[model samples]
Target: MSDYLVRALAFEGSVRAFAVRTTDTVGEAQRRHGTWPTASAALGRSMTAAVMIGAMLKGEDKLTVKVEGNGPIGPMIIDSNAKGEVRGYVTNPQTHFDLNELGKLDVRRAVGTEGALTIVKDLGLRDFFTGQVPIVSGEIAEDFTYYFAASEQVPSSVGLGVLVNPDNTILAAGGFIIQLMPGTDDETITIIEEHLSKMEPVSKMIERGLTPEELLFEILGKENVQLLDTMPVGFECNCSKDRFGSAIISLGESEIRDMIAEDGGAEAHCHFCMEKYNYSVEELESFIDEINS
Candidate 1:
């Protein structure tokens, strides 16, 4: 089935919750980028968390997440919007390492222990928001949790996980974000802590075919949770040949002439999708004419 996300409130609106199943979505990214196991986990977890962040926006509002670490995987970039569309790519898609002590992908080792996680929100009308926080743990989720508390001042518990197959395909990918609101009673907090501590990893739950709603019930308990609307999620990239062409045109008529002279043509590639757009000599000349006109 295609991936999707859910937004709900628990503890009578004192806690906000989000969960998603990203197996298909992350799988597409793996196939497109040829990511290794460790790198897949790193990028998958980041994209899963990003989908939740996108759920918080409305209409044309969107956000970008940059996970720049000192590890082998380098920096990962993810974009998402209120519509549950998310796309991402890692600087080094083939990075991988042996499993950690927990017999899981060594995401921290691939992601590094230093650097920063930065988020930028384009809210339209020149109302933009930027937040940056040091990467406390290269485990993707912890870094985002830290970003929430330090940058957004939101006390949130974030769990993101991705399991890879022997052939380096995505077996399971999912996440959950629980945010505590003001006036949440101490009793509720302790209850949530207990549930999270006893539950299995989020990825395992997803592998077992638990739906997003069930994932929340596992995290916050069915008695205390209130289900909200769900949103369809998928791996979607906005890059197109025309968009790249326009970018080439922006390089100006003189630059187009140089391309036409030296290489005989120009090629543009998108980092997000690894799509290559080749402009023949004729196309280059047309762009020059368009610029001149």
Candidate 2:
């Protein structure tokens, strides 16, 4: 099934929740980046959480999530907007290791226990917000939970999971974010915590083919959750040949001339989607003209 997200409220709007089924979305990233099992888990987990966070914004607002850990997989970058579009990549896609003590993907080993998770939000009109927190857990979900409490100052519970196939493909990937708005009573918090403690892993629930709404129902109780709206989610990259060409043109006429004289052409590669754009020598000359004009 195609990926999608659902928003909901519980306990008369004192608690807000978001859940998403991202199997296909994460599969696309695995295929495009050739990420190994461990690396796939790390990248998929981050993207899963970031997409849900994206749903919290409005209009043209967007955010970028950076996971910089001191492990073999290096850094991970995810970009998402309020519209449910997300794209991401890890520094080392081929990184992997044996399962951990819990028999799950060794994400903590691939993403070291030390470093930081940073969020940069671009609100329209040049308004931006930045939040950074030390990595409390190499597991992407726990790190985000800490980020909410320490950085954003919201009490939140985050559950993220990615199950990888033996051939390094994604089996399932999804997550949920539950938060308490200001003025939430203590009784509501205790009830939510009790439900979370008895829930299944988010990845397993997703693999069982639960829809986003069902995922929320399972976590927040069907009787308590008030379904809000659903939005489609996918792996989308906005890079194009024209966009890359514009970037090259901005390098000035002299730089364009040097490219034609030395290399005969230019090639631009996108890290997010692994797409390459090639410009012929003639194309290079036109860019120089465009720059001069």
Candidate 3:
């Protein structure tokens, strides 16, 4: 099935929730990056959360999530916008290890228990917001929970999971974010806390073919959740040959010429989607003309 996300309010608007199913979305990323089981889990988990967070933005605004953990997987960078578009990459996509004590992917080992999770929001009009928090757990979900509380000052529960098949492909990937808005009553908080503690992992929910709305219903109760809207989500990269050529042009005519001299062409690789853009000698000369003109 296709990937999509839902935004809803519950507890009479005192609580905000977002849920999404990202199986195909993450599957594509795994195929593109050839991520190992553990790395796939880390990247997929981050992407799932990042896309849900992206739903919090308005038009034209976007955010970047950076996970700089002190582990073999290195740093992970993900970008998402209000449009339900997200793309990401880990510095070491092939990183993997035996299952942890829980028999799940050793995400903490691959992600490390140190470093920081930083978010930079581009709100347009030159308005930007930056938040940073120490990585509480390399598990991705806990780190985001800590980030929301410590950096954004919002008490939130972030559940993220990515189940990889034996072939290193994604089995199921999804997550949910429940945020307690200001003025939340104690009773509501307690109820949500209880539900989250007893509920199954979000990945299992997705694996069972639960929709985003159903996932939210399980978390917040069908009666309390007020369905807002849903948007399709997927792996999308905006990189193009023209875009990379322009970047090379910014390096000045001398740099562009050096590429033509040293190599027959210039190749630019996108870390997000692993897409490569090639600029032939003819294309390089054209860029030089554009720079000179």
Candidate 4:
């Protein structure tokens, strides 16, 4: 099935929740970046959480998530919009290590134990909303859970997981975010906590082929979850030759002339999707002419 996200209200609207399946989306990322097992897990987990966060926004709104830990993987950057389009990359795509004590992909070791999780939101306004917090846990889920509570002052539980195949491709990738509104009663909170404590890992659930709705029902119970909406999700990059050309044009005529003279061509590389755009000498001259015109 195609990747999609489901938004739901539970406990009579006192709690908000989101769940998404990102297996195909993350597989695309692995193929694009050639991430190793550990790096795939780290990047996939971040993208899963970021996409859910993006669902909280409205039209034209978007957010960028940065995981700058002091690990071998360097850092990860993920961008997502309300439209369910997400793209991301890691500074070191080939980083990997042996499994941790739990026999899991050593994400904490790959992501380091120090640094910050930063999120910048574009609300289509004059000022952007930026929230940052220290990495309480190198594991992406716990870090985001802490981010929501400490940075946004919203009590939340974030469950994210990514399983990598033996061939360094994505096996399953998905997550869920549950938030408690101000008036959520203690009983409801206790019940949700109990459910979470007993539920399977998010990655395992996805590997078991659970749909987003079934995933929520597994966590929140069928009677308690009220599905609000669903939207398709995938790895989508906004980069293009024209977009890169516009950037080169903005560099002004002098820079364009230098590119034509020194290299006879220019290339722009997108970090998110690893796609490169080449500008030949003639293309550079046209940009110069466009700038002059």
Candidate 2 ranges beyond 4 A from true positions = none
Write out the backbone clash pairs for model 3.
none
Output the number of the lDDT-best candidate: 4
Tens digit per residue, CA lDDT, model 3, 1-293: 78999999999999999999999999999999999999999999999999999999999999999999999999999999999999999999999999888889999999999899999999996778999999888999999999999988999999999999988889999999999999999999888888888999999999999999999999888999999999999999999988887799999999889999999889999989888988899999999999989
Q: Which ten-residue region of model 2 has the weakest summed lDDT?
A: 284-293
Candidate 1, residue 106: lDDT: 95
Each model's lDDT: 0.94, 0.94, 0.94, 0.95
lDDT of 2 by residue, 125-241 (tens): 667899999997799999999999999899999999999988888999999999999999999888888988998898999999998898888877899999989999999999999
User: Cα RMSD (Å) per model?
Assistant: 0.8, 0.9, 0.9, 0.8
Please identify which of the two predictions, 2 or 4, would achieve the higher lDDT against the true structure.
4
Off by over 4 Å in 4: none
- Indicate the residue-level lDDT of 8 in model 2: 94
In model 1, which regions exceed 4 Å deviation?
none
Tens-place lDDT digits, model 4, residues 153-211: 99999999999888888889999999999999999999998999999899999999999
TM-score of each prediction: 0.99, 0.98, 0.98, 0.98
